[model samples]
Target chain A: MTAITVDRLHKTYLVPEREGGLRAAVGALVRRRRREVHAVTDVGFTIEPGEVVGFLGPNGAGKTTTLKMLSGLLHPTSGTATVLGHVPWERDRRYLGQMALIMGQRNQLQWDIPVLDSYKLNQAVFRIPDADFKARVEELSELLALEELLRKPVRNLSLGERMKCEIAGSLLHAPQVLFLDEPTIGLDVAMQRRIRSFVAEYNRRTGACVMLTSHYMADVEALCRRVIVIHHGRLLFDGALEELVHRFAGDKTINVELADEHPLDPAALGPLVDGHAVERSATGFSVRVPKAETPRVAARLLAGLPVSDLVIEEPPIESVIEQVFEATSAEVDGG
Target chain B: MTGERLDADWTSGPRQAPGEGGLAGLVRHDLRILRTYLSLGVLNLVQYRSDFVLSVVNAVITLATQVLGLSVVFGQTTDLAGWGPYDLLVLIGVHFLIGGVLGLVVRPSMEAMMEGIRLGTFDFTLVKPADSQLLASVQVVRPQALVDVLVGLGVVVFGMTRVQASLSVVDVVLSLLTLLCGLVVVYSFILALSTMAFWFVRLDNVLAIFQSLFGEAGRWPVTIFPGWLRIVLTFAVPVAFAVTVPSEALTGRLTYTSALSAAGLALLFFAASRWFWFFALRRYTGASA
Candidate 1:
């Protein structure tokens, strides 16, 4: 069953324009200049129940804007979206009871109180039965390792700990649809991994659909199987992680090691593998070649040099996504 | 066309939680949620023990200033606008009482709401299952302002004892009723003012204008002010109804007409404020367009 379906969801904001100097400030009071920003344009996607989809985009690429539309915090300027069979922005109590949105940078917990008190407030807000609420809290605590952190005031906890509590509080109702906007942002590598694993475990346990946005490739690689990529208010690519790499990234990288310990001179491979970026490292050198040429290039390299070992791998997902956006901007600039 | 699209997909239909969709059910659910907010507020107050002490001191200082000011005025005349010294004391006491309620829950809640909107945390409130207006109104708890409430009650009792008016059960009942009406009016006014934060986003100064005007002009009876100013305090901001009308009930000056008008105005403003709040919410969420 589809848990979320968005059709041509778009958002446009009228942002006021301003210029520097006292004269402009004075003029703004008299007649303000405003411009329209197409935050999200003709974006559409669908997520099945229990599917964890990564929403990938650069800063200000409308990833947050699209999430806001899905979570009911915003209304689309055009198109329509339904989460769990309810129009999100209508804000039906049943719809709200079944969905939760957690922003990593913005805290919804009471600042000066212990995390447990804020959790109780959520329990009240969602009207979860006492036994159910307690059971869910216990389950989430074990999943997120939140036992000790729940007793401390939010202000006292470190950023990573606070985010864990925030996530736990938002899920007190055991929402069926989870919208997480950079849930692991601004955290150390270890903490990010912890959050990512917890999210995956939670989704598995509850069969809840998860839509997450993050800058860290490790987060997407670890938690999401499918990703929806948006750039400049438009959908750029949407597919499985491997397919995103396959479609947009046309090159594969090969690392070739020589029998001797000395580093291989990158210039020696000239014309043999022309039009590929080759870099030399301590042990060996790696060459990026078009996906179709990878086999031929490796066969030629083995014949041309004293290659002891060779391995071919897809470029890192981060660089693939970067290439996608760069290509998009080039197209945008050309048009 | 969108309706057809929604219908095609909703094979299971939208789940209707039993006994939980109507108005009464919503109110009952929101009241329970309010209890949690209040408890959380008290927990916040417990964390900052010094704020309690400071609030008490602040209440004491405010009471002293009002008393000193009243005494200085009494030294000039035995009566102003047919209200004796004790009568005016009762009036000032009501002012503090109303102000105490506003300070405790009304004003702080509005300020919290404004801050939430500016910081984008208001989205949290909007997404909650409860009604957004009820959540915004009861989100902040101010136990420290209980000191001001108690002090105001004390002054009212003392002023009543000093004044030689033969009070009846109806007078006492009327006073309480008028006070309740005044509270509703002031809360509605502030709620309407706070809703402007959805548009202005920097309405602290605009809110302060209401605070300063009510504090300064609410001490005296509205009748003493010039004709145009009296109209404003009475109808513009409803300060006269918040302070003077309740004091009049205690001083044997309240008429049936005044009490009825206060109640009617309270109802009117409450409805207007509620309408404005949802309207603002629609605009904030970009739902109207």
Candidate 2:
């Protein structure tokens, strides 16, 4: 079952451009200038039921804009999107009740009130039954470990604690589709892992489709099996995380720990491999060579010098993603 | 059987626990928010005890001034537009009463709506299932305005008794209905004004203009104004319906035709404002997209 279907969705914003100085500001009062920004253009995707898909993109790359469209906070400039068979922008109460959108920077909880009070307000808005509402709140509180925090005013809670409450509040109605835009942003690694695990547990138990966009890769890696990468308002890659690494990573790193510090010329080792990249430390050095050339490079190094220890490692995910984006931009520029 | 069982399990899936506990629960809900607003309004009035005292003093001074002005005018002439001092006092009292209600909820909410739009907090309102217009209008309650309401009601009672007018139960009912209609008219007028925030982002002066005009024109009967100005206040801005017509109903000067007209106008404006709210919401979401 497909929980979300977005087809050729387009969203453009007309942002006013104002020059500095009093003269330009005064002139703007009479006649303003605007430039059209196509925040999302011809983007299309579908999420299967219960699938936790990570939305990956650079800043200003239309990730938030697309999520806003999906969540019914925004209307697309063209095309259409249906979540759970309901058009999002229409804001049908049934559709809104069945879905939740949590933004990291934007808060829905009332600042002066206790977190529990804010949740109660959501209960009324979502029309949750009393029994169901109570059970749901208890479950969220226990899972998020929000036993003590619920009594305190939202303004008093820490960022991580507030985010937990915010997520819990949004899920009170047991929404079938959750759109999370940077839900774990600005959180410490521990808090991020806590939220990631909570989300994973929620998804596993409920089978609700979750589409999360975050700058933190740990959030994506921990929770999402399938990731959708978008760059410059276009889908760059949509597949498994491992596949993304394989497609973008060209070489593997071989680090060797020597018995003692040794001075070695990088140029001398270069001729033995198709491509040679080397970084040296006091007791060890890491070298990157083409995957196929790893055996030949390792054999040549071992024969040439006494090797104490060696380990092979795949490139970091961040670097692989950056390389993918760089190659994509290069292709676009080439055209 | 297996497919049916799977469907049933999927439909009746595990429910997540509620977010807040009991007291926090009440505050979080919408109805509870309204209750808290009212209680907080009372609490706020207690906190500003001096302001409340000053307001009552101000109301007494204002009522004294209105009576003195009426007496001075009637001294020179037996009657101004066929209304004696007491009749006009009733009108003045009704004006304050209606204005008090507006100040209590309508005006503050409109101002809050404008501020919410400016601060981008209106998005918090849009996501809720409640009608955005209703939520924005009743989000805050002003306890200070209750003094005006009480003073206005007191003036109405004293004026009626002093005039030696026979106040029947039917007359009281009619007056109440007219007052209710007047309140609706004022609410719809403010709502329509606040809805303009979607298009005219810089409309701070717009709501202020209504208050200033009402301060001046609401003091007098609509008949005292020139024909065009009276029409503008009556139909265009509907301030006449808010105060003048309702006061006339209490004073036994209201005609059936005018009462019907006020009622019709209130209904029309209420529907129009509701339509405008949805339209503004559409434009807001569309433009932001």
Question: CA shift at A44, candidate 2, in angstroms?
Answer: 1.3
Top model number, TM-score:
1
DockQ of each: 0.31, 0.20
Candidate 1 per-residue lDDT, tens place, A1-335, comes to 69999999889988779999999999999999999999999999999999999999999899888888887878789999999999999888888888899998788887777899888888778877776767777777776778998888889999999998998898777788999988988999888887887788778767889999999999999989999999998998888999999898889999988888755556767766875778877667888999999899999989988888999999999999999999999999999
Model 1, C-alpha of A335: deviation from truth (Å): 0.4
Residue-level lDDT of model 2, residues A1-335, one tens digit each, is 58999999998888779999999999998999999988888889899999999999888889988987787777889999999998888776567768888888777776755788677667656657677777877877877789999988788999999999999898887788998989988899888888888888778778899999998888898888999999889888889999988877988899988766666667766674444667877887888887777888888878776689888888988888888888888997999
Off by over 4 Å in 1: A261-268, B1-21, B285-289
Tens-place lDDT digits, model 2, residues B77-157 = 877787778888888888889888888877877887787777665766765554467668876566778888988898888
Off by over 4 Å in 2: A18-33, A263-267, A270-277, A290-295, A333-335, B1-80, B85-89, B142-147, B286-289
The sequence of per-residue lDDT tens digits that candidate 1 reaches over residues B19-111 is: 276887777787788788876776577776898899888888988988898889889998889889899889888988998888877788889
